[model samples]
Target: MSTTSVSISQKLTLSGSSSCNPRLAQAPWEFDAMPGYGPGSSEADPVPAHAPTNAEARPGQLPQLYRELPEEDLHERIRAAKEALGEDLVILGHFYQRDEIVQHADFLGDSFQLANAALTKPEARYIVFCGVHFMAETADILSSPEQSVILPNLAAGCSMADMADEDSVEAAWEEICEVYGVDPQNVTPDDDGKLPILPVTYMNSSAALKAFCGRHGGIVCTSSNAETVLEWAFERARRVLFFPDQHLGRNTAKAMGVPLEQMPMWNPRRPLGGNTAEDLQQAKVLLWHGFCSVHRRFSVAQIEKARSEHPGVKVIVHPESPMPVVDAADASGSTDAIRKFVAASSPGDVIAIGTEINMVNRLAAEYPDRTIFCLDPVICPCSTMYRIHPGYLAWVLEDLVQGRVNNQIVVPETVAAHARVALDRMLAAKPK
Candidate 1:
């Protein structure tokens, strides 16, 4: 895809001068200069060195000037930039993002929906994704070549996605091939002409892994359609390797009547993935040891508390939550599913949601008559999702107005071609 510069008749002036925000002048995560503190560093605290120190930092921090600017001024600048750019720009926001950023989004939905939204906007030259890193990468893989996908903050990365890197997964695949006595080069299909094993990656994974799936005849799946994708895999493969989130894989497979004994966890750190040849042979689904930090926080205790405090409360959670938490909740679904659940509820209905704090708060405000609150009283937002501050949004948009593309996410041509096959298969899989 060719990258085109946006031209504006009038240069939009930001609320604060460039001097006021020194960090904004340069990318925060310049890991090349800091040898020991780049992304995926083996430090005790896995956060990148350039991650924001706090929501409010001293004058030198990247967002300090943004924090200092009046909310009205920031809003005004964002409006002006959007108006000046017109249809060439499209802003996509996730439900979990903070109100400050979500309010400025032209389209709001979950990651999969947002990726599809990017495809629909063929006229949009730039897709400013107000979500995490992987979501932008997905948009880049699916959108037209002429369209450029921009991520506001480089630090906005998914911890779950980081857990299952391409190197680790590739290594695991080789070990599995040996354990199953299957040749990676020449795989003999079953009597039914199905492959012995298939790799099914969650939509939250990297583009490289999606390409890996495409090359191996596997497909991608979102939380909303995981079961459907799994069924599709099972029909053509004897066993499946599901990755990035063990909770989702286990829960979905269990519901489909797969026994726990048949599902084994693959620990990348251990030899043979911490499983014996016998264990591998009996496995129906090999799950990766990865989970979402936010969803992992939910517990059955929280569900009980909601039930005790408000009798007849409806408990709905994301499928990423642990099996027990999902089982205890009244229902579990994707972010869009949670929204629809609340919208379908009657007035005065007491609903306790198990998701990010920002989304629950927004729902409460949108439906004032209904009593909607987060299950966990303590504040816990997706730290990665929170990285897309309004300041970053303004910075990227303003850069576009000046005929520049900042933090653009582009997948390699071969990778995009392969990844698109899996994504297209996902789009075709009908939900049964």
Candidate 2:
């Protein structure tokens, strides 16, 4: 709801920062940023006045100027980055990142997992986040202010994270309070309290959102730990109001055998609690109408098609997928879980995966003997992640090498304290 800043420790080693060190695995590829051709630093290739601009032009006349740039000296750059920065810089990669980038990551995991990984790295003065914007922001919030956090590309962001913003959250809170005569701040234990109006936000939200949950006596949850987190929330609250992605909340609750009729959809724009008698009285969970555009593209029909076309085709989907998509899949989990499954499965197994395109492509390459394809065979990527091209990563790393730090994400002080409240609650929750 409001912004605040937090101070971070400037230590550079991962040991002093986090309580534990994450075990990293070697990647199949390498990162190479050529010396002279850094992002936004190269001399623009000049267009000759005589060059033909149209496709109708003859091949020679069209553009002899289209020469490929030299490939980055992968090993050399990696050695340089490691040697120069040492513990001062920590590179974090999400499981969904391309293999090329993942190869260079000091830490690799899902969004919340990566943030948890970054928090323990107190030795690092700088964190170069390789995931979406919200993730980097989360790192900033969780870490000390002295430690700088940079997103390789300022443009990099997450669609699912963007679905709910400050205004929307405030508006919803206002309506809930107005209709129910319940203060979000005053909810507490009762001998027979109907259910606490507990707010469960996904990890894919802004730091401010997390802080809102924290200040309001709520907690945060990731895809892998949703069930346990929800169980924790339910014990304290009268009813759970899960935000951003309705699909994840619905799917997890359903698996727990909570009937579909008990979960109501919250409409912030509506009054009367934004619910019908059946929706409010019978509700166990209140799901928001947000979803990931990428995951939502996966359909039951696609899974059926994959099964029909190939025998033993296992369908694995992200929890953010639509209800039907998750229902049709053989299994569902977080990005890291999906990768682990593919890695552990026997060779020659056919798998249809529902997640971001880059991850699916990487899995297909890694497991050549096994058939792997996207559940939605469309040519779309996580638009925010698409912003983190090799060029962007190189530029940010280069900046850290210099005294300049561009696009540093900082979670404000007040917000960080409140957000920590929610995160602390989550950390205390036992696994189901």
Candidate 3:
């Protein structure tokens, strides 16, 4: 049987040789104290170096007692807490989460899917989200006010989400509106009945960015529904300003036959987003300079290597990868699409996947009859998602059972109102 998770975890614990960072062998608490994105596909990314360490962002330490407990004991504690709380609690796990955490999840899927799951449990008082910060925030936004969303660890933040902030996006919007000679807050449609631009943010972004989209007649999009969302945007606007994920924006638009020249990259650091006014005017989609660190590690070279090693290998990748990598893959899609692809494959088919190692590994374990493996051979998971170890999940669940809500993710009411508009549009834009 293909046991990728076992190999990866063994390397992390016993050898520490499969990963780029040897520090990954230590407990998460040991590395959370450091100033970096932690060990994973983003181990070398420059963006996380300047951001606050996981320890600093967290409300308090994970506590020595929890960290010192054995892995099996921690799992038992989580199980006990769940039993004690019964229907009052629901745990949501992302596709990229570790096996230990995923096994404990009441709902296992992508960020949006998991968020939607929480809504189904209206009677549940607490939502323990075993995902990144933005995901928990999204749950808090979508669920009823009485329900609470908790992140297992405060440090589990997306590096890509950090790339685009409110200030940078707001500044770009002002400049773009000026170039079009329109008010940033109140843009009017031209004779063609299309607004000058419509803001669109990926699900990987912060709640503030999503709120910005809501206020500006924009919509939020997941990787699976991005094309449909873009089609929705184009129906109301001449151009789409997509943020917090350049690859997803560019790849989806390009698939829809938008010319490369018409999709410009917006660098917030540069003047006019480092583009000429003429270029901006001609653009169909303005992609922000942001990307998921895990997906960014995929390359055309890796695809070629997989193809060479296993003839007739079907390579599937996430759209968050670079254009060339997606182009080289046999198919590129969201996490759910990838899962469906594997499910549809023949029992003996060889599949190479380009995504977080944990997700790929889980798929491999699920379909042991097939030769399913990650395109990137390195055992790097998403650093942020990996931060949600069993220890954090156990601690959070126990705390909730004890009537304490730790690491609760609450979005401001004003922001949630606007964000809800964009999210609702996203829900409506789902292709028929």
Candidate 4:
């Protein structure tokens, strides 16, 4: 989620928008280039761009289309459902969700932020999370037991989170403890000095894993505030164990000037902890062997190509990408930061985005005067995010209207308590 203040001339018109369906809109969006305006140059020409590459092929990438209502009727139905459901319904959309569903979100942010938002709405009996399954579970953990969290599509899941499960994480933690010849509880400290290990989990993880973190004085984080959460951990511990997203963990630690060698990737499958004391003793961050398939698809070549093709293009990428990919781009940040930079940017600027395809397309539409295109030339939408179709959203809302709760996501009481501790730490870190 990074932004750049570069400028370019002309509008972008890629070939993919003319498809009959959203899924078929695969052609590269075209943008005009300005001379000498791109990275390393004050001005340059923008080049034609390609679609996103390495999109995760999540199952049910397309939900079944049950809604046959016309545009006006559909909106009317959605409004009526909301009115009937009243306080019992809440819609939460993730930052990477399609604009169609996001436009209807009552609350919008990253997974961690969205979960926190859900907690504030005590009156909402049913929280319809518009993100992936893990995000819905996070909201469930944060919300009161009396509340019900529903995912529009259960298939929506984070691939990164899938990389780390409770068993695997537990194994890794044990290995870390054994290698250090220290108890997990005695490894890290908090201001209270009560908890032994500060088990921090990423929002992308499973509820069970999150429960593990909660049980261990750890919290969850989205890409936006991961750095702050990690920093908070350091203040209370000898080292940090970041789960479910090695890229985010590595990049955040790197941003803090933590030596790259200090961050070791823990592999639960094999022993020796997948790291050495040299790597661990010097460790500032302990990364789980996990990654987002979609984010990892971004490459340095894409950025370089963008620069050469679009003479004046500014490169902006999400930190979830590999370090090289992030470094190749002119800027890196959260998705919200990227959007803000583009919306408020000056006209005639060229932007090459390294994010989901739908998001880049929406931005291009929002800024017609500026040249905007995605960094990856292949299809690269987050498969999990794409699982949340308007059809599924409408169905979930309609079910709530009918006084039925389907697909309710609930974290156990024990797990909830621990998860809250982790979540509270993050909320406290939010800038006042």
RMSD per candidate (Å) reads: 9.0, 13.6, 2.4, 9.7
lDDT of 4 at 413: 77
Q: Residue 218 error for model 4, in Å?
A: 2.5
Candidate 1: tens digits of C-alpha lDDT, residues 74-103:
778888999999999999999988787888
The global Cα lDDT (0 to 1) of model 2 is: 0.69
Model 3 gets an lDDT of 0.86
- Count the clashes in each prediction: 0, 25, 0, 40
* lDDT of each residue in 295-346, candidate 4, tens digit only: 7778898888888988988888888899999878888878877887797678
lDDT of each: 0.79, 0.69, 0.86, 0.68
TM-score of each: 0.86, 0.80, 0.95, 0.81
* Model 3 TM-score on a 0 to 1 scale: 0.95
lDDT of 4: 0.68
Clashes, model 1: 0
| Cα shift from native, residue 151, model 2 (Å) | 0.8
TM-score of 2: 0.80
lDDT for position 390 in model 1: 66
Winner on TM-score (2 vs 3): 3
- Candidate 1 stretches with Cα past 4 Å from truth are 1-67, 185-188, 430-432
Please tell me which predicted candidate would have the highest TM-score against the true structure.
Answer: 3
